[model samples]
Target: MSVLPDPGATRAVLIGTSHYDHLESLPAVSNNLTALAEALTGPTSWTLPQEHCTILSNPTTAEMTMAAVRAAAEQARDTVLIYFAGHGLVDPEGDLYLAMPQSKQRRVETGLPYRWIRQALLNGRADRCVVVLDCCYSGLALGTMGGPSDLADQAAVEGTFLLAAAAETRQALAPPDETCTAFTGELLDTLQTGIPNGPELIDFGALYRHLRIRLAAKGRPDPQARDRNTGARLALGRNLACLPTTATTPSADGEPATARSWPSPSGIRTVRGFFKSLADVRVTSGLTHQMVSQRSGGRISPGTVSRLLNRESLPKTWHTTAAFLSACGVPDQQVAEWYAVWTRLLTDTTTDAAPHTVPHPRQHQKPTTLQRLTGRLSRRNGRSRDHRSGSS
Candidate 1:
C-alpha cells in the first residue's frame, strides 16, 4: 500500500570501504557500492537523477561524515537513503561503529560512530530516512540498553527505517570469490530482477522479508530491521518481475490457471497444533524435503525443511515459517494469515518459555500488526537489558 518516493525530491548516499589498513579488507564491497548506486538511480528503480546519488568508495571517517552532511544539506523533502557496506566494529561496551580504512579494532575514535550518521539523518528535512548496513554485527545499529554508552537512546527517529545484514552477535558473510558481499549481492539481485508475484512497487517491508528468507535459506546470517512511524511502508522501486494479469486469468475450463491449494494454519492456538499443521501441509504438498527446498528456489535448505517439520519446538521466527510455506506453494494472503496466527501464539506464550505446553489464548482473535510490533518491541527491550557485551 506504499507509494514510491518522489524521485526529484530524494537523495541517496552510498559508502563503502573495500581496503582497510588495520582490518581484513572486503574487496567485494567496492562492487556493492557501484552496482547499488546504479540500481538506485536506474530506470527500473526510483529513477532519481544521477546527481541525486553519491557513491563513496574506501573513504576516510571524515570523508564519510562530510558526504552524509552534504546529502543531508540537500534537504530532500521526500526520502533520503544512506547505505554502508564495510567492516562494522563494536566496542566492549557494545556500541556500534562503522569502520574506515584506518579503523582499528576496539578503538571507538578510529571509526565513525553510528550516532554521527544518525544525527546527520535526523538533521535532514527528508520526511523519511532509510539506512541499510551490510557488515559484521550491523544489527547493533538497531540498539542496545547498556547505560549511557548504549546506542538505544539514539535508536529512534520519527521516520527512520533500518535494515541490517546480521544480528547483534553474528557476522555478515562476504564470500571472497563473489562479486559483491553476500548481503548486498542478494539485495541488488532482488532490486534488479524483482520478486515474482510481487506487487507493482517494492517497499522496504517486502524487501526486508525477502532478504531474511533468502539469507536464511542459504544458511547465512539473517537480516534484521527496525522501523518507526511506518517508514517500512515507503516504496523503494518498481517490481520488474510482476506478472501480467492476463497470465493469471482463469482458463476456458473455469478453473484458475496454475492454481495451488495449500493447507490453512487457521484457528490454531497451541504449539503442538501448529507443528501438526505444518506436518499436514508438508504431507499434502506430497514433496520430499529436497523437493520443497528446490521449489523455494534454494531459499530453504532440504535439511532446514526436514528439521522444521520434525522439530517439536514451534518456529521461533516468522521468516522461517513463511519461507517454508511459500516454498510449499501457499499464497501470499494465506501466508499473511499464518503470520497473524504465529503472532497470536507468540503473544500468548510470552510468559511461558516452554513451547510444548499449550497456552490458552489471551484473546480469541487474530492480532493486528501493531499488536505484534508492541509485543516484539517489549521482548527485544527486555532481552537488551540482559544481553552481554561483545565485539565483532
Candidate 2:
C-alpha cells in the first residue's frame, strides 16, 4: 500500500541504563529493557530476529561503545532501529547525552554523545533508521519540536527518525509498581494491542501519536517524534496480536504468523475516494465490523461503520472521523490531510456547489503509482498522474 519498498531486513540495538556509579539508580530502567527486548524478539512487535538484535543492559564503556563498534547490522539494506531507556543529561550547551553506568556529571565526555550515535547510523548502509530515546533529555538526539524535521533529504535527516519520551528540560517519569517507565509502558501497550484494533503495519510517527494520547490521558508529559513518513510510510512491523486470524493467517489466538500482504489501492482523491481507500485498508487489515465496534467500546456501532463506508458522505464530526480513520489504519499525519479534504468537499457538495457535482477524478479507473513525495493523486485523461514530492 505504501509507495516505498517493504522495509528490507530488520536490525535493532536495545540499550537500558539503570545503575550509575555515583548518580541515582533507576531500577525501572532494567525492567524497560527486559520487557522491550522480549517484545522486539517476540512475534508481536518488531519481530526482530534474535541474532539481528543487540541488547545492552547498563553496559559499561568496554561493552557498549557507540563509536568503536560500527554495528555491521547496518551493512546491508535494512531497517535499523536503536532504542535507549535510562537517565539522560544535557551539556552546558544543551546537547543530549545517554547516561551509562560510567557516566559522570559535569563531564560530557563520559556520557554517550548524541553526535556519535548519529554518526554510527549515518555511516551504516541501512535503508531506514529509527532512534527512540526514553530519557529526560532525549530531545537532544533529534531537533526539538517545531524545528526543521524534513530530514527525508539526507540519510542523517530522512532515513533516521527520533522519538523522545519527554522534553529536554523534563524528567522521564517512572511510575512505581509498573514493569517499565510510563512512556515505555504506553508504547508497549500500543504494540501489544494495536492503535485502533488490529496489528496494521505502521510507522514510528503513528506509534508516537498513540503513545502520546494514552500517556496524556494519565497526566503524563507529551512525547515528541521526528518523522520521515510525510512522503512514504516507513512501517516498523506487523504485530499479529492486533490482527484477526483465519485459516490462512495468524491471529491473537496463538496461530503462527506467516508472510502476507494487505490489500490497498494505489491512492485516493475525493471524499468518496477517502472512504473507498479506507474500506480497502479496513478489510485487508483483518478487522471485522464486530472488531471495529468492540475496539470503539460501543461508542461506534457496526451498523454505523457499514453505513459510513457506503461513501454517501463524510462523517459529520471529527470524533467519528478519527475513530473510522483509526480503524482504517490511517496514521496521525495523514489523518489531518483526510479530515481537511473531507471538510472542504463536504462544504462544497452541500453549500457552495451542487450535490454530487464535485469532480471525482477517475472514479472508475485503477491507479498506477501513488505519490511518494505528496498526498495528491489525480486522474487526467482517464490515467492516474501522481504529484510527487521532492527526492529524499
Best by TM-score: 1
Candidate 1 C-alpha error for residue 259, in Å? 20
Tell me the TM-score of each prediction against the true structure: 0.58, 0.56
lDDT at residue 76 of model 2 (Cα atoms): 33
How far in Å is the alpha carbon of 361 misplaced in model 1?
A: 83
Residues 220-304 of candidate 2 have per-residue lDDT tens digits of: 6777777664522555545435455632343464322443354332333345445545565465556677767765667778997
Q: How would you encode candidate 1's per-residue C-alpha lDDT over 326-361 as one tens digit per residue?
A: 776666788898899888878777757676767788
> Model 1 segments beyond 4 Å from truth?
137-156, 243-392
TM-score, cand. 1: 0.58
After superposition of all CA atoms, the RMSD between model 1 and the true structure is 24.4
Superposed by TM-score, candidate 2 places the C-alpha of residue 384 at a distance from the truth, in angstroms, of 93
Error of 2 at 128 (Å): 0.3
TM-score, candidate 2, is: 0.56
